[model samples]
Target: MIVRPRMHWLRMLFVWRGSVVPRILPRLGFFLALACLAVATGPHPFNLREGPLGLLGVALAIFLGFRNSTAYDRFWEARKLWGSLMIVSRSFMRQALTHPSPALSLEERREVTDLLRALAVSLNHQLRGTSVPLDALDSGVRERVVAAEHRPARVVLGLAEWVARLRHQGRLGEVLVTSFDDNLDRLSEVLGGCERIAGTPIPYVYSVMLHRTVYLYILLLPFALTGSLGWSTPLVSVFVAYTFIALDTVTAELEDPFGTEPNDLPLDAMTRAIERSVMDLAGEPLPPPLLPDKDFVLT
Candidate 1:
């Protein structure tokens, strides 16, 4: 999330806001002291063979590479799923706007448009754990809508019920209701998918085991390399620790895509865009889009 130039050495060192060093430094320091003592107090310590250290380095490289790749795959998958949800949400809004309902009066059509806007806003608020603005609804409708636990889905189902009632009253034809139902189903699918991602996470035990493995590997690395690398052990340890720890950090942050972390997908901006589009469909003056920050952060 914190973008920096490729050649910025200072930023690169501190890019993850010191997250890497804290996890890496303690073990690294201990190893450095141990390596130094082993070299200074003993003869031929620096003449150690490189075969075991080389093999360990190779193994660490492979493990870090695989871990980082798998974590990146999960992160990208989450982004793709949310992107699809946005597209489907927009498609449902478009359908609601253009789908013909011949028997509705202009006022009734306007009410339907309003309902669509409300649905978008409510869903946005619901997903983000914000309050729904019920003052915009009629008193009886407002009370009923507010009483529901899942306000967004309630509003959506309420719209479907309205459509069904209209059909029963001969004000909406079967074909139009069916089309509307299809859009509703799409919306439901989108909601369900988002919920699935938000609710489920990579298991805690797996994460804990991976984290412990990475750390233990890093901790033992210097022991294997100390005699061979000597004074260069600290520098080598830092580099090696950086790779393993950074990979672990990446996975930890990315595993939960809906979190408020800077690295997470821009869900707030996404919801606002959906709200603006739905309101535009209602013929209302659109609210401004949420702008990216100077540092490229999105709310």
Candidate 2:
């Protein structure tokens, strides 16, 4: 994610690191060249008349706007789920560490805390389709989780088994068990949410339709404007192309919020935050927060 201070509107005009312009520059240049060709060729029988473009522009804008909104909604929802994951991970550790229970030893509490930390890292791995970073796992935790069918979900089930064992030993009363279970359920819910987003993409048909429409409009637009704008067609057409192009690119990046792209959710940073929170509760020194790049992009 591109983390930055709020820039003045004027400064934002020159901001490049966080903008979509870089990604779409190739397409923008292509359309700019097309605009120049249309102008140089002057009028032609096949030239698109500018008079009929207004209605089509409005309709296209509406479709693009809706598509962009849908993508942002998915991005925001994924962020929220990760946020909740952090909360629940900490809460579970807190309960295991501080709750009064003669039957639960310090070692048992530590084991549960380690599990919480491993779960946080594993779930992030699952979302990103990557293996758990070795540094994120404590000794032995990695090897055991490697064989699980779904590493993150299995860690959660491992948590459930721990609870069952504690309850069986009468170390946890029904009331105490309920609280821990509640937070475990929250963790499960968060994992399920992230999985849903990662697995179920916006329908391919909708994406293809919007993608083709944006390109077609931008490519054909220069033809319409060149007749009236003449030599200035490249300037006006490139500006128009940039708007449509930028929006389309931004939407595509955001649609998969778990990606490592500059604009996607900062899953690495968020996962580190969860690790730190769990460590604090485990009575370990918290690691430093992950910093963004020089350009203010974290992950």
Highest lDDT against the true fold, candidate: 2
Residue-wise lDDT of candidate 1 within 1-299, one digit each (tens)? 43334647776555543254555567657656655565465444345455765675687667657656665666677566656555655665565556545544556545555565566566656655778875754555566567888776776787787677777777656777887788778667756765666567766676777777767666555555666666676677667666767677766766666665566666667766766766576666676887767655675
Clashing pairs in 1: none
TM-score of each: 0.75, 0.95
* Global fold similarity of model 1 (TM-score): 0.75
Query: Candidate 2, 163: how far from true, in Å?
Result: 1.5
Candidate 2 lDDT by residue in tens digits, 1-299: 99999989999999998797788888888888899898888787894787667677788889889889999999999999988998888778777776747644767766676788778788878888887775655566666677786988888887888888888988788998999889888988988888899999889998898888878877888888877788888999899888877887888899999998899998888878887888787777887999998989998
Per-model lDDT = 0.64, 0.83
Candidate 2 lands at a TM-score of 0.95
Task: Report the number of the highest-TM-score candidate.
Answer: 2
Evaluate residue 199 in candidate 2 and report its C-alpha lDDT on the 0 to 100 scale. 96
